[model samples]
Target chain A: MKTVKEGEIRRREILDVARELFVTKGYDHTSVNDILKIVDIAKGTFYYYFASKEEVLEAIILDIVEEGARRAEIIVKDQSIPLLNRIMMAIMAQTPEFEGSEEIKEELHKVENAKLERLYLKAMLKRMTPVLQEPVLECIKEGIAHMEYPTECIETILLLGHMMFDCDTFEWKMEEYPQKIQAFLCHAERMLGTKEGELSGFLQMFGQMP
Target chain B: MKTVKEGEIRRREILDVARELFVTKGYDHTSVNDILKIVDIAKGTFYYYFASKEEVLEAIILDIVEEGARRAEIIVKDQSIPLLNRIMMAIMAQTPEFEGSEEIKEELHKVENAKLERLYLKAMLKRMTPVLQEPVLECIKEGIAHMEYPTECIETILLLGHMMFDCDTFEWKMEEYPQKIQAFLCHAERMLGTKEGELSGFLQMFGQMP
Candidate 1:
């Protein structure tokens, strides 16, 4: 039997090969056999790591979620940055980016892979909520002492941000995009009890103002 | 060829039969042949109305969307009700109820039908936004003369309400439900420029309070 470390290495190899294939070729077009061929692994070995191609995709999604959570946690803990900016950065960090892989991002946007896209968003939100919640509560405590906000507002804000901004969830016209962003900032300020334009700096971060 | 009225009647007949089947037998379990056999129509007749079973579902969804928009329009146009209450009613009207058909709602909740659920939510939001937008804009104009909220906020608020409250989108636990509703109400108050307890009457409408 292979050692535990060796088995772990084999699994990582399979995932890396499958992720590349999924990005280069669409998820619907990528096959387990193709992954096995690229990784030089037997069918048994592929099955040993993942039951099917869908599971491989799920694994990749989980990797992205974990990475995002890691980034958000670090941002949340950083005290040098202003609290509101850190909170903004922490929330923004939850959005999963494929790093240098724009092709994978484009592939996920295709109609056929919509279900996969939904699954990824749901998974990322589920994992990142708790990581970002503490900082959100801290901001509320520090920024809005007079207001009695419920703890559940953190999740509500996160869900609103995700649904409003995610292209897959709510498709706004190109012309309407800036207006929507401005409204989001206004609502965000109201919800977080920040003064108007306190979060305007965030607009500069995006290099656009509405 | 059938007259235009007869064709429309025939199409409704098929949809009614398929909708009953989808609710009772579940969308995945109900086949095109099942619908054909129950409607007492030939395959060609069924296909004449809908391209496939999926198309039939889409038609059912559209019917629900149109019905919701109609109800919301009536609520928005009622001059007797207060503006905020009308706005709340208009937004709530967008949620599609099967009208004594809880089975269909439960069916849509099943894991296998998540894609259908997503499609339904997307269609409902897209159709309802324009219908509800006018009333929302009116409410913002009448209620918040001091504040300059963006017009795009109508869609953002609707999207936030749907995502936060929809069981499919965010699964709040039984105990967490009350807290979530309170948070939503607070945020809604802030966004609409209403006083804290001005919208508390909304909780009474639901027969519960946080």
Candidate 2:
């Protein structure tokens, strides 16, 4: 392997330290001084990479969004995959925000401080929309062509599903059950008017077969 | 109509004043004195009915929960209605606790008062749970009976739907479009594994024409 660059290594170290400190001490509760002491980096160096604490947060969020967008696009493009399998793959691929414990807890605790919660929520919805939309839209096209579920309500279902996923705070416990997640996705595909047994096998493919 | 009792009228008037005030001044910022002032009652008179400000808040919540529970049960018992229809109707039936202009302004001025926000959130969720649960259980039942969708995930959907509705701060300009709401609900019901056209004619029933 080629030798790692000083800048890349240093920046990665900074993010790791910052993420831990932010997670443990909280964003508002943790200060620049604490980060400096923990990482042993000059404040100037920290400032060189990040203009403000908010900028660091912005970087972290961008990481989530960029990764989310990539995964969503990848699954959406895999047209040969069955709709339900693609849905399951998309879910596991995206992992959403809650899937990250350190990230989820820290963000929630710091929500009162960052003024970031609402924006974060909106970003989350936007992030997931394509992951859901691409497959559902394709499925709808097929369903309509074949005259499956009523065509009149297609857009309505899509928007509502989008809103619900955007806003709903399914208990954290539910995440513990992968079977449940798979089931729900199947339910969504079915509503889009996919034929039965067509997507049934997908239920077993998302995160540990139930 | 028969004359309303002085005590009953006075109590409801107090609850009305307290609910509005709690939303505005916040649970902590607005005290017993403020509620009494708004209701035009003396401190001792307020104490006569409610031992403390919390009690008055509790009374308001209890009223909401009781009414919500009653309505939710009624929806649960309707065999003629589709499962998705019941869930959407239940959501429509329960009043959403929107922060009024005054309340939003006050909270903005204070900024980042988490404890107060959490308390208000808890009280509101308590009022909302029954309104949210019936459809979840129904989805499970219907999914299993028809082998419709994964019966297991319905719980997560309900749990998430409640929290999202409670915590979501997005500007909802779309509620005015009842067709959109109907489409979303019908689709969501399908996502939970019910059949299409299950809620056909649902929009007209709500008095929204094609």
Candidate 3:
């Protein structure tokens, strides 16, 4: 039991070291010997934790995506937050990828990396999709409950997704930001035919959409 | 005279051939011999055209960015379209790098490459900054010209630039989108305490900020 616990702790330490070195020196310049020097681990021990550097990279990508899904779940579930605002918060989680490895960038062009990116995108979209549908649904429900009629709430919801939340073939460099995204949601509300004052409080709660 | 002109033409063809090769086969894999075989130009001709493969790469980067700047300028100046809409269109050029070179990713990290990136960024900003500023300026000008005083045009302009235009940082990526921008614009208009929507068309001009 003691040996097993010690092995698990040591493996975690190795992963931590690998991540820092990979992000800094990048995967190419970083060698097994470099990992050994940094982690103070034997070759056999390092192999025990990860089969190859590529495996380690796969792990990192999964970890980042998983963390994002977790964040999206937390933010999306808050019923007090309007659906539109929550969707924005969830969208906020789509941070730029770490640019440590040009190798990674190259891989993005390849079939395998493309698939991985698609999987991650799908995961991200799933978490936030409900945030998109739910709020608009609630808004309509509120209107209906109050005996107010929206001639086209569902169409409005779909339009909001298309104009604001829809994806495009154009490359969105999550890395090179030079401005903020607040006007986007506010303008979205306006275009959705919601009055400024009524939806103002709702729009304001996005707290910076993920 | 004929010999000299023929030599210049041959040299130009070699660079063009090499450019296509690099894009398809990548820089490292494509060699001088490969370029010679494809262009059917002699080794001497290839050497005459480019001192080395690296010089050709630098030239390609210059051409791509320079051409992009020129195109952006054209789009920004088309007065037939609404200025705000043009500004958003201008943003499409900004994202080209996201789907661009693996070479660029590697280059940005090296000291030489980092300096080059900074130079490129400065030049691109100089070219694109005018467009970013122009829409808001035009919106405000058009609004005030129509007697829309105490307006909230400034916030909308800034938010347009911050949110939709910039998407390159991990912070921007992580659910911390610059949401204050919405409040800043919305309240700025209301705080002016103006009755009626002097700025309603002003918002319309900016199109969708998202």
Tell how far residue B152 is off in model 3, in angstroms.
Answer: 14
Q: Pairs clashing in candidate 1?
A: none
lDDT of 3 at A58: 61
lDDT of 3 at A198: 43
Q: How well is each residue in B102-133 modelled by candidate 3, as lDDT tens digits?
A: 54444433433433443444345445555555
lDDT of the structure predicted as candidate 2: 0.55
Q: What order do candidates take by TM-score, descending?
A: 1, 2, 3
- What's chain A's TM-score in each predicted model? 0.86, 0.55, 0.54
- Residue B167, candidate 3: Cα error in Å is 14
Please list the residue runs of candidate 3 whose C-alpha ends up more than 4 Å from where it truly belongs after superposition.
A1-51, A80-133, A136-210, B1-29, B32-59, B75-126, B132-136, B143-210
lDDT (C-alpha, whole model) for all candidates? 0.73, 0.55, 0.50
Segments in model 2 whose C-alpha atoms lie over 4 Å from true places: A1-17, A23-29, A36-59, A78-84, A96-119, A140-179, A197-210, B1-17, B23-29, B32-63, B74-88, B97-179, B188-210
Give the DockQ of candidate 2: 0.22
Judging by TM-score against the true structure, name the best candidate. 1
In candidate 2, how many Å is residue A104 off?
5.3
Q: How many backbone clashes can be found in candidate 3?
A: 20
Model 2 chain B: lowest-lDDT 10 consecutive positions: B144-153
Candidate with better DockQ, 1 vs 2: 1
Q: Give the alpha carbon lDDT tens digit for every residue of A31-142 in model 3.
A: 8778888888788978888898766666666666566656766776887766556655554543324445445444433433444444344344444445445555565565
Tell me, by lDDT, which candidate is best. 1
The better-scoring model by TM-score among 1 and 3 is 1
